[model samples]
Target: MEIKIIVDAMGGDFAPKEIVLGAIKALKKDRNLKIILVGDEKLINPLLEQESSDLNVEVVHTDQFITMEESPKAAIKEKSKASINLAMQLLAENQGDALVSAGSTGATILSAAKFLPVIPGIERSALATVLPTARLHPGNHGISLLIDVGATLHCTAKQLVHFAYMGSYYVSHVLEIPRPRVALLNNGTEETKGGEVLVKTYRYLKEAPNLNFIGNIEGTDILKGTADVIVTEGFVGNIVLKTLEGASEILKHAGRYAYRKRLTWKVGLALLSSGVRQLKKRTDYSEYGGAPILGFKKLVIKAHGRSNAKAIANAIGVARQSVEQNIAEHIGDSIIEFNKQHRLDFIDI
Candidate 1:
């Protein structure tokens, strides 16, 4: 079956040009892919012309666009025809199978929740991203799934439990991991660490039969490939994510300085170029594509804010895999069954 995706042409910092170019690249790569470009026609049409005139693409012109600094609520309300809002509406109405955006994270999440129905037994949706782990696993790219990377700022114990199951299922099906191990992010490796919410969530997860609960893991455990799915609330998860990003940047700059400052370092860099390139690829956020807002009715991918053409294309790849694997539906049904099997009142918001 053909997988249709809606791309917010004006959502990213490199709007229309990079976004459109990426969409065209995706369409060329996947014959089953079709795209609906949402943005101003004047800007988008010319870009489309640069690509092959004969591409499976549709354009939806909109006058309004939400800027990066604009308030999500105000932008959505005032700019009803905004690219993000309209793209989401199209997905809800079944105009497409998935929606991808490199726009404002706050605005995209707010609009998606308002526009799409929640998966059964899920009151809130969480963002899940594939992060490159420090250790490489067989037949994998040294990557693991990180959930709640900043969707819901605050969450209850039950919500973290929900994120665990959803993240596990996502990794297993989408990433093709079998029985992925799950862990809770805490300050300590002991079972009794973390705040009240995490402590309570640990108990719930431990008792959950379906999940492959592997006990508690600390912040340092994340990049070490300690767990398949690291479950935490958005606040902590976001901090960990940004810290890694910053560290990667620092490493890149430090390597450049070291190479220029010493002759031996220059020779070492030339010899290690292959390894360094591989390491860079693994750490590059763009290579992982966008984070999926799990537990939603339709597939929604939140691409990075400064996403370029390649990043946008990779986000489309993630969305395509998700649709093919039927991840959204599986998570909805699995959560319902999990609640029933455990005899717990989890569906309550």
Candidate 2:
């Protein structure tokens, strides 16, 4: 199947340059993948000459671009021609199978939630991202899908439960994990540790039939691979995500400084260079591509704001995989079944 993906060329900090380079790389990789670049043709077209510029890739002209500082709702309402808005509109119109953007996170989420209908029984879409872990899979390093990384800042216990179901289904279907273990992120492992909502969610997950609930896990357990899927609200989850990013940066700077300074430390680093490179690759954010906004009618991936060509290509790959895996269809069906079994009335948000 030819998986068509809409790329917001003007959305990110590097913008059309990195995005175009990434799109070209992705197109070269998969012949069955088609790319629709939404941005200013005047700026994006010339870059096509730098690569293959094959018919598989097309550009939709739009000079409007939304910045990181812009209000998401206002941008969506006013900037009708903005790359993110137009790309999403194209997706809503069935012009593409999935959409990937390194643009404003808030704008992407708000626009997707507004234009694209949420899956039945889903109140809000959750950002589900895969983070590296210590354990290794057969062909790849270990990764767990962390739900609600930054989609909805505040979530009700019911919403967190919904995220848990969505994350479980995602890992099971996409990651091919059988009955993947699910864990709630809390301050402590004890059932009495978290606040009212966390406590309530713990009970909900524990009592839910068929869920491989393994009790609560602390922040330290994330990279230790304590659970297959970690479920939490966006506010806390985003903080955890950013903390990992900051720590990775600090380690990288320290490693550079150590290598440039003492000869003894440099010699030690040289001995472990191979292992160090492997570890860095395992922890790199680009390996997992971008985070997907789960519970949506269509697949929408949110890449990092400072994504490069490699990252953008990987994000496109993630979108392609999600489409091929039928992630949206599975989530929709699974949510409906879950609501029916739980006797919870579905209400449109």
Candidate 3:
């Protein structure tokens, strides 16, 4: 089967240059893949022509695109011809099996929520991402899934509970883990922590069937791999994700500055080269591709805006794998069963 991936070619820090290159890389990596890049045809053709010969890639022309400065809702409403919205519409219309974008997180989320319906019984969607952890769980290879990393900004008790199940199923299906451990991110390890909303979320998760609810974990437990899945409201989860990103950036900047300024610093860095390589292997966002916007009818990968060719290629690969695995159907089936078991039309917010 030919797996078609539609990418928002105009939606990133590097636009057609990096996006086109990345699409070429992915197209080359898999012969059964077809890539559709949505952007200015003129700008994209030049970059794409420089790469693969006899490629199965297509360019969907559109000069319009949402900018980082524009509000997601307003831009999406006004810019009906924007690349991001067009790309999403293509996915909604079954033009592609999956969609990938290294664009504004808010824009992607808003656009996706607008064009793609949520899975049956899933009250809300989440931005689910993986983080490398210190403790390696058997079969997991040292990473944990964290959900709602800025998709909704805020969530109700039921919404947070829904996130836990989505995260659990995503890890299970995508990572091939069986009965993955799920936890609530809280101020304390106690079930009573994190105010009333979180407490209620904790209760719901704990009682969820077919889920390995491992109780609450604190922030320090994040990198420790305390659980395979960690659930938090988007506001808190996004902060945690950003904090890790900032920390990694700072370390890299400091290393470069020290290496240039002092011979002694250079020598120290050289001595720690092995450890640093391992750190990069674990913490590098490029290696993980991008985060999945869970709960949508179709798969959507939200790559980092600063993504380069390598990262975008990886994101495309991830989207392809998700399609092959039929991840959306799997999650949808689970939600349907859960609703049937509870005899409820929807989880109350």
Candidate 4:
């Protein structure tokens, strides 16, 4: 299948340069891959020439683009021709199968909301990141899908249930997990914890047909790899994601500190160098490519703003994989089935 992907060439710190290089790399990797780069032609076209410009690619010249500092609302309104906004517009127009952007996440999400239609019965979209876990799954991958990493911060129990379904289908499709175990992130594993919203969400997911609900899991249990999908509100989910990111760096700093303070510690780290490298490789956010903003008709992958060419290429691969797997269609089917089974207007029990 010739998968078409739209790239926001003006996104990220590196902008047109790295983004153009990454798109060329992806094109060279897959002969059937077609890419549309949206940015200023002067900037992007020159980068294309720097790399292999003969690959299957097109440049959609746009002088404007959203910056990280700009608010999503204002950027979309003020800059209709902005790279990120135009990328979303192209995806909505079926100009591409998927869109990948290392731009402002807020701009991406808000633009997606304005352009793409949410999956039927899904009240709002959610941002999901596939985080590393301690144990490997049937696919031999140590990762779990964490939903609502920053999309819909304040969510109701009904919406969490929507997220659960969204995350489940996504994991099953993209991660190749058969019957991925779903769990609610709460203060405790007990069904009674996490106040009324979580409690109600627990009950709803527990009874959700075709869902592999595994009850609740604590923050400590996240990396334990007990569950394949962790469902939570954007606020808590974002905190957990960021904490994990910081904690990984903290461990590195701690090792360096100990190495400087004690010769014995340095020797120990040297002995465990292979394992340390492995751990670092597994925890690296760049390896995951990008986070997928789910529930939209067309998939939108939000790569890190500081992404380099390699990371951008990986994100393109993820977007292609999702498009090939028909993730959005499957998720919509699941949501339709869920709404038919339960009237989740609000779960206030």
**Would you list the rank order by lDDT, best first?**
4, 3, 2, 1
Off by over 4 Å in 2: 136-141, 344-349
Model 4 lDDT tens row, 1-349: 7999999999999987888888888888999999999999988776777665468998888899999998888989999889888888999999999999999989999999999988887888999998888874443358889999999998888789889988988788877888899999999989899888888899889888889998999998898888889999999999998898898779878988999998898899899999988988887767887999999899999999988888899999999999999988888898888787776444442
Compared with the true structure, what per-residue lDDT tens digits does model 1 show for residues 1-349?
A: 9899899998878887889888988899998889899999999998888877779999998978999999998888888889999999999999999999999998999899889998888867998888888764443437888889899878988788889989998888877788898999888978789877888888888988679898998887788887889998898889888898888789889999999999999999999999988988887878888898988889898998888899999999989899998888888777777677655544432
- Highest-lDDT candidate: 4
Q: Write candidate 2's Cα lDDT for 13-47 as tens digits.
A: 89989999999989999999999999999999899
RMSD of each: 2.1, 2.7, 2.0, 1.9
Evaluated against the true structure, the overall lDDT of model 2 is 0.87
Clash pairs, model 2 backbone: none
lDDT of 2 at 191: 92
Each model's C-alpha lDDT?
A: 0.87, 0.87, 0.88, 0.88
Off by over 4 Å in 4: 136-140, 344-349
lDDT of 1: 0.87
Mark the regions of model 3 whose C-alpha exceeds 4 Å error after superposition: 136-140, 260-262, 343-349
Q: Name the lDDT value of residue 307 in candidate 2.
A: 92
**Per-residue accuracy of model 3 over 21-78 as CA lDDT, tens digit each:** 9999899889999999999998999887786579998889999999888898999999
Between prediction 2 and prediction 4, the one with superior TM-score is: 4
TM-score of each: 0.94, 0.92, 0.94, 0.94
Which 10 consecutive residues of model 1 have the lowest summed lDDT?
Answer: 340-349
